[model samples]
Target: MRLRRARTIAAWALLIGSIIGWPVAAFGPARHEPQFVLGLSFLALIVESASLLTASQVHEETGSK
Candidate 1:
């Protein structure tokens, strides 16, 4: 798959996982398990998105060398 599509899918998965996982973590009776994945996934997703955005912008400016 293309990098763009892969990144988009990953971002969505992480976004949704984080969202769903947050509620589960809060209302379920767990202190660490669900929240761990939720927080980490969200953080990784944000970083991935930022990196992808930066790469795209760089490529745009650099003529996709």
Candidate 2:
């Protein structure tokens, strides 16, 4: 039960973070602060990917084992 809840929270966080980070990348001085903007975008992508992967894992486990 606890693990399931944790996974749900993580998945939501990842999804939300990705949604929030895109605009910052789009309009936040991309050229002058390429590294920072790119880093945020990369992190957002990673989190989004991880969220999908973790969702599949949760589904496969089906709260069993």
Candidate 3:
């Protein structure tokens, strides 16, 4: 479990979770508020972006593609 790999996995998980969760929250029987769902999605995206940036930096420091 390298840091880069861990971050990459986390980023992917967040992205996929949001992709699936957004629709479920929007159109599913739960009927969550749109603002709440959008807030959560934005937060997930920000965290995912940070994780990816960190992973990229790690890869750059390690000189690995």
Judged by TM-score, which candidate is best? 3
lDDT of 2 by residue, 1-65 (tens): 76667666667676677767666665675646667757776776877767675775677478666
Candidate 1 has its poorest 10 consecutive residues by lDDT at 56-65
Judged by whole-model lDDT over C-alpha atoms, candidate 1 comes out at 0.61
Q: Write the per-residue lDDT of candidate 3 for residues 25-45, one digit (tens) a residue.
A: 667755656668676765777
Ranking by TM-score: 3, 2, 1
Q: Judged by lDDT, which candidate is best?
A: 2
Q: For each candidate, give its TM-score against the true structure.
A: 0.46, 0.51, 0.52
Q: Clash pairs of candidate 1?
A: none
Off by over 4 Å in 2: 29-61
Give residue 51's error in model 2 in angstroms.
5.8
What would the per-residue lDDT of candidate 1 be over residues 1-65, giving only the tens digit for each residue? 36655555665665566666656766676665667666686577667666655665555556535
Stretches > 4 Å off in candidate 1: 1-33
